[model samples]
Target: MTTENLLVELFVEELPPKALKKLGESFASQLFEGLKSRGLVGADETVTSYASPRRLAVHVCNVFATAPDQEIKKKLMPVSIALGADGKPTEAFKKSAAKAGCADLIEKWPNAEDGPDQLYVANDGKADAIFLRSMAKGTSLLVGLEGALEDAMAKLPIPKVMTYQLEDGWTTVNFVRPVHGLVALHGADVVPISVLGLEAGRMTQGHRFEARVDPVALTNADCYALQMADEGAVIANFAERRAEIVRQLQAATAPLGLKPVEDDALLDEVTALVERPNVLVGKFEEAFLEVPQECLILTMKANQKYFPLLDAAGKLTNQFLIVSNISPDDASAVIGGNERVVRPRLADAKFFFDQDRKKTLESRVSGLAKVVYHNKLGTQGERSNKVELIAVGIAAMLGNEKLESAVGTAAKLAKADLLTDMVGEFPELQGTMGRYYAQHDGLSDDIAFAIEDHYKPRFAGDELPRNDVGVCVALADKLETLVGLFGIGEKPTGDKDPFALRRHALGVIRMLIERDLPLNLDALLFVAAGIRGFSEDVAGQVETFVFERLSGMLREQGYSAQEVDAVVSLKPQRLGEIPKRLAAVRAFADLPEAPALAAANKRVGNILKKAEGEMGTDVAPDRLVEAAEKALFASVNEIAPQADAAFESGDYTASLQALAALKAPVDAFFDSVMVNTDDPALKANRLALLNQLHRTMNRVADLSRLAA
Candidate 1:
């Protein structure tokens, strides 16, 4: 079969980055459906889409050369019968017959039982002019539809939009980004034919400067690889661009006795930055190293799109690798240009660092009062008070009396850097600035380190706080953020997380789990008692509410709702103990008969709930009579202490193992036993044993909520 390719290119001005990605994907999806809906499927059809700041292109290959070429029926009638009272088809029967093809095609419409039985008219020889006009009308309707589509996309909620090419004259297309050029093709033909007041065509301009108007011809469906290479440009596929940048980056920077800094996000950003990438090395004054290495590298990668070079010892080098759009003839000149741009960025950073050094850590602490924590909660000063409370409470809970005062002191100043000049200029340096200021102020090693460590695990898989004071302050800070925001009804909903409460909650979880602190979340809530955001009663309530939210926040770390519920049900005091409980439940979950075990746990729960529907805590153990009941009772009594010890030792699996030993005995007792005996004492004893079994099983996990 002979093949033909249809390429449509829509040239516009620069489009928003976000819109470029969205429009390309949306236009392709809609066009595919539009053609299919028109009953025009090309034999073995395919479409390839491409986009840049200035243009959008799509190509279709192996088109049918013509549509199915099926006959379409048409008919006309006298104005009185087929037309309206004015001029068009008048009678329903006549209009129906005309629409169907002819009067006979309607068959015995008003007379037949089958209803609307019509003649099978021969439409193959019908004149094309009739439906050809109809097709033109459809095309006009489609133009309107595409206009609406563009308006809808522009109105989509986004952070920012740039509209240099909006045809409506106002120009600012309200989108996360701007919409630039668009080209759409269907088998070498324009699909909707017109969009953005521009007709779609087969010609595409390449690489702005390289291909210029090279036609980007394709023998089949468009592949940008050859087109880009022939045009002295890089093909802009992210994956291909990433591979090329990395390979050449490694080769280019190797000669400098340094390796390219491994920053995945920066690498991904650079991959999107250029149409054709040319990796080269750039250098800066080694004296810039006097500034914090983090600030130096952040200045480079964050602003200049450069990757910092590091030696084998992992020390920052004076050199960096830069990915450039243009491959220059003089590599030295390009490097010189990059050095000039980056020099000022690093200089400002150094100035900020030096200015921050003048203030004592204690002086900076007072400035935190000006930082807004949340609108509902007052200022960072009020928030810091709660952190101090949390730190003291966790210290007491963990029996770290030695660090209690120190933890309190550190927590008070942890966020003080937020108001510092260094952090103001470089928002990423909030915690690091605290540590630097603390050191400059001649604070003790522990306090300065605590200031730095408090914001640990800012993201999932990031490092956690390493010191006692750091862990305490970290928990206080996170719990305050969570409870304060959630109390004011600022909880995250759908895709909106206005306060980053989820990340704060996850940070708390990671700090607790990784630090292994013996802190009770409930007790921490009590310390948050002094917190100014909500009532004492509501504060306690918010803590429990935020606990569930925290568990949800840990979802990305691989905890499921069932797993989270089971952990929460155990009433683990320290967030650190959650992982241990999660591991135990996960292990129990792996067993083939885990479903049965969960059933056993739930059965124990249901029996106690029914018996003690209104009973208070502390069931009396002496009211036994049934032999089966007494046997189960003694077995549970024997296992509770051992399980308790195992749990205290953090051997959750061992605790469950001890509790499961009663499973066989309990199962036997259930088979041979009659719990609801005539005597209320025996019934109460059975309920008490069930409670003991439930409580014992809960020592490791509340298996009732766990999934089989």
Candidate 2:
């Protein structure tokens, strides 16, 4: 048989560019799959997806011209249930039996002597709507493709689906936008299908400005793409359009003493903006070049879609270029229009710079408190107060008096620009604006830097604190946020982190680990206790919760979860020292003889977990064990304090070193003496030794379960 193609077009009002491709792809694939599973004949297939920022269409070829005959599942009721005890047809089963075209046909095919078999035939009809409805009923016991396809369309995935239309506008379907009509045909025959209220037809319109409505018929499977091409449309993939834009942009800018700006994202954004890609060279005032290149570039890219260009030395070239759908001759006019559009944006930047410089940055500081931070979290003024408090505490701890004011000043106006109209409109500049304002006011460079750097590393793999002042204020900012939220019992739960406590915690981690700063969570909590509104219990709970974030962070860094648990199990108050301790423990753990020593540590842990709140610091070593056991106990007594000293001082390497001293002695004791010895006094002494090791090891990290 000669191959025949099928075509469909859901003409719509202006559709969101982002959603057009997604909806088109989904409709084509889902419809194709649905038809295939129904045993439809589609010898070869291709789906051409195209849109014009207004309409989306999927043209399928060599697609099912008609459904193929196949066995279908049919359901039958037991005749015994269908008939009444009086040998009369029951109304319950009679209606359904009649609809199935088998009124009382069940009597001729009675249920077997045993009982009903409960089998079903999904569809038993000619290839058309009647068959589709039958197949739509769930064939599988569970939800099959029927529900999946419908559900997939229920909440159309991708952008712009949110702006639902009140009336089923031009699209003919009630959707996020108004629809126009549906054009569909199968093997030159119109397939009866309705999508978004648009009925199947064989005609499609093209380029609202370029072509008229035409009844273009797809000839063959391969003709689909070329057919759409003739309709003032390119039915090729989006990636082709995306790449073509880049190539043309480069070529257009090549002779203009400029080069296309290297920006993949900007390219992607531009691609979504145009249907037929064309690059047009444009020019701007060379005098505007006196302004910073970044400001000028931002103006063109953000406001005009005109990509800035640079010469050999990377100085801003007065000319810029843009991509438009029109021809080269037409684009010259478009370029002129874009260049004219960007002039005002550049002028505004220059004016803002001039106006900002008229006054000192100090004058902007007063504007900070007026800025609202959060509805309930008070103004930036209140957050400023918390930031200053934290900075002061950290400064004193670091013994850096110079950093105190810089840190405090940075904290004071960290959010100063939130009050500025610029930052209000462009929130990304909150910290950066504050830094600019502070520097303009003639504040010390360090404070200005801190103001800007405090929010560094906003997301994963971002830059972190770059200076002592920045680190101090950064830690304070993150800690205060974590504490304030957790105090109110607003912890992050699976996929819902309204407060972004995890990022704040990560910032804290990167600051400590990357900067190698000495910090005590206990000390940090004590400072957090100063937040004023928090209760003592709330303060403590928030503190523990933040500590858990650290624990989880460490575990993710390839440390054993059990190893982290061991150290945290010690009622940890100082967590900044944890990573170092874990590293040191991990290092010592890798020693060849570490397993037995780890076993000793695990045995020690088992004793403590089994103690079930039985014991305290009072270990009765007066009840001595055998001489060898006594020697091991003496060694533990000596090294325990050394380990404690190192741990308390945050010298975890030293702590693990001291703890490693016990490995040999403990290994010797396990080999020579049994803790469950026949003598009660000896057993008690060995138990005391185990407790001593547990307590000492607890100072650094719970090494018992640490993986080598």
Candidate 3:
């Protein structure tokens, strides 16, 4: 089979910047996989994808002009149905062979062997079957590449598509942007395929302004990237363009003694916007820095697609970097134009800040009543009240009455920033604006900090609330969300969490576990359920959801699934104590006796589960009829109290370690004693003894979960 490097490019109008990278990746992966599945691509071949504002392309090396032929066997039917009296072909055989597109040669084919390898014999309730073998012709690159292009087009993650007409002005095609050109080259030969109403060609237009040639011509698939760069003034590869931008950013900032604000998403967007990037530095008036740097940065990055530079102290400077499409010889005109464009953006941010500070957070509290939190749940005002109550209850439980006032103040003002002009302009700065307003209102530092930090740890690995008041408020806020959403039967289902209840639950888990807070998760849910208009029945469901999140989060933090299952299966109320319990479980698993004890613990649990009723922990010595049972009872009596003491002292490792002494006796009891004896007294007593063992062994975690 002849082979060559293949290049496919779909040139369109400017695509959505955020979706460009994914679009490029999917185009390359899906097309390559489609070809490989058809045997047109070699095993050692590799693909490189290119994405820009106007194009999505892929280059594959070692692509075959024609796929290798495949040999396949077809099981027609049972021998009785497929063959005549002399083992000749029957009507059913002819029909089956025709359906497989090989009727002309079926009679010449050898008889199928009567063996287990034949697929149809077993299903047809026969020991023998008829089979036909044929060689399928290889598909030409033109036909295979067309199908691949169609499949790739169908799979692009285009949130929305546009319909346009080709040159004939009657036939319509749908794509992300209006389709302008298509390039499909197999070595130096055109594959002769069409997609999105455009015929494959060897020519593609380059940079809108900087191209030396209008339509760059490709001589072969291997030289596409180099030819485009030399003549078209465009960098086709997304990663290379991004790296070049990064290099320019670093070099540009080095002379100014500053660094660019680091944001991968912003960089990706800028890279997608320009095919030929020119990084330039622009500065605004220093007076605009009076506004919070967050507002300025948001306006610059979100609205203008600029990278705000920061000084060595990590403070936002008035200077910023712009990734422009054109690189002029003088460059001063570009810098002046960017500076002029950004001044109004910075000025608007400053205006919103100045106007928002005039209104106090307290005054804005009532305004939240008009904003609905959810249709089933009430307004933000009502939500804030519930959060306040939950925060107060948590503060009182923590025995910090002094923090109740601060917590209340913070929770009340937390959502007030949603009404601020600054926050209205930039919703990402909701908590931040509240803090600024709180400080402006002469509130204490703790209260101001709480107002800002209530939404801390908004995402995974985000920082927790900084102070006691903040902790109380953050917990209350997350609980209110979980309780409210879960109560209304809005629990997350298989990645469809419209309310972000999963994130809220993970936030609650992190605050409890990472902060070492003494809050009881069940108790917190119980208190939250008692709040007005909330259902108490959903408490278990909410608790399960939160613990489920914790289990997955712990596994992600490097804990094995078994360890997480062992610890989380107990549903320990104090999440803060989980790390210690897990530590103890790990330490116990390392001991020589852990396996036997764990298996015995599992056996004991199963035995108790089969009992007629509740088996009390009181093991009567008079009913200990077997020598093994007597020894086990004595061992439990000696070791359980020590384990209980260690458990009470929070020495989980020691508690689990103490139970190691009972492993041999436990093994003997299960081996020799009949837990379900003929005598009712003996059965009940044996169950009670096992119950005692189960309780002692599971102080830190359900050891049975550790059994292999």
Ranking by TM-score: 3, 1, 2
lDDT of 3 at 515: 85
Using all chains and alpha carbons, the TM-scores for the candidates as numbered come to 0.78, 0.75, 0.96
Q: Give Cα-based local distance difference scores for all models.
A: 0.66, 0.65, 0.88
lDDT of candidate 3 over 590-644, digit per residue (tens)? 9999888888888778877777877799989998999999999999999999999
- lDDT: which is higher, 1 or 3? 3
Instruction: Give me the runs in candidate 1 sitting further than 4 Å from their true place.
Output: 1-8, 16-49, 58-192, 212-225, 232-234, 531-536, 549-564, 586-597, 612-627, 637-650, 660-665, 672-674, 677-682, 706-708
TM-score quality measure for candidate 3: 0.96
Instruction: Give Cα distance to truth, residue 651, candidate 1, Å.
Output: 3.6
lDDT of 2 by residue, 180-244 (tens): 66665555566555555445566655555544235455553345456655665542445667878
RMSD value for candidate 3: 2.6
Q: Which is the leading candidate under TM-score? A: 3
Model 3 Cα shift for residue 642 (angstroms): 1.3
Candidate 1 lDDT by residue in tens digits, 487-511: 6777677888877777787777667
